[model samples]
Target: MTPTVQSLDHLVLTVADLNVTLAFYTEVLGMRAERFTPADGSQRWALRFGSQKINLHQAGAEFLPKAARPTTGSADLCFLSDTPLADWQAHLDALKISPEEGPVRRSGAEGPILSLYLRDPDGTLIELSNRL
Candidate 1:
């Protein structure tokens, strides 16, 4: 019998600057930043949202045996938002982060959604969306 996979637990990201990435996720996207020391005695950082998280590893100072082809600006991730799309737009405006593209319609994991696109400090494309 084959085993079935469950939901995502976390994702690892190699960032050019840890502080800049942390600031963008926490300040702009409103995620929680956490620090941890793994068994290897290496310091690690992550941004938590609800039940999911994205681990951060500095580009030049990554853990041994990382992704085979880890590079900055390589990730494109989408996040679901509970708030209204208009509110999200306003928040982005107040923060002065321009939207690369969106409030466009897009198909999500569950159903149809309205998505707003932007880039993080590392040039990773981020999509913020709300269910339609």
Candidate 2:
């Protein structure tokens, strides 16, 4: 039998500052901050948008079975936007967050994507794109 990879449901991000990370995702990127309690009686945080989420693990306090070398500023993530890239740029500009790169052409999983690249507080390269 062959095992197949279905899709991405979530990923973990180890962060230095929880509040700053939360604010960047929730306030700046329009994700929702949510708190969840695992069966082990521990509280955890996640940033939810659409059907996907990023679980936030505090540095030095990550849960069991984490990445081998979990560290801040190690993630380069891309998000597909429902809105136009120009509007996303405006949103970023209004927040006074300057992009490190462009709204240029890039190849995405589905098709061609027009993208803007920026860094989160953790220095993770965040790509916001719209499929063309």
Candidate 3:
């Protein structure tokens, strides 16, 4: 028997402000919004990040409790960069997105990679990595 295998399609996050989340995903993270359906009559919204499409729906309060917030950490979303750390760091700086400082060296990642950690609008941790 073979186990099921699938690539990550998209991650849906419950956001307080849809515009803010969209801005952060596009302006800050460099993802383009492929399409957007106004919340007038629909209950689902679709956003494109590269080739991936994320579905966003209005969630009720109490979805993310204080106790569950920290435990979720910042690994919910990840993106790989062709540029190295120096260039990526400058990109983040240009956007005024100050990421938490962590180790900077070659590690056994997908390859010789540099990793940086940052948080999204909804407090979701995002990993930006580059392969050497």
In candidate 3, stretches whose alpha carbon ends up further than 4 angstroms from where it belongs are 36-43, 61-75, 103-112
TM for every model, in the order presented, reads 0.96, 0.97, 0.70
Write model 3 residue lDDT over 21-108, tens digit each, in one string.
7788788767776555444543455577667876554445322222244222233565677767677678889988898754354453
Every candidate's lDDT? 0.92, 0.94, 0.65
lDDT score of model 3?
0.65
lDDT of 1 by residue, 1-132 (tens): 999998999999999999999999999999999998889988889999999989998997778778988888899999999988788889999999899998999999989999999999999999999999
Full ranking by lDDT? 2, 1, 3
Clashes of 1: 0
What does the lDDT come to for candidate 2? Answer: 0.94
Error of 3 at 84 (Å): 2.2
What shift in Å separates residue 89 of candidate 1 from its native position after superposition?
1.0
Candidate 1: minimum summed lDDT over ten consecutive residues — where? Answer: 60-69
- Pick out the ten consecutive residues of candidate 2 with the lowest summed lDDT: 81-90
Cα lDDT for residue 47, model 3? 70
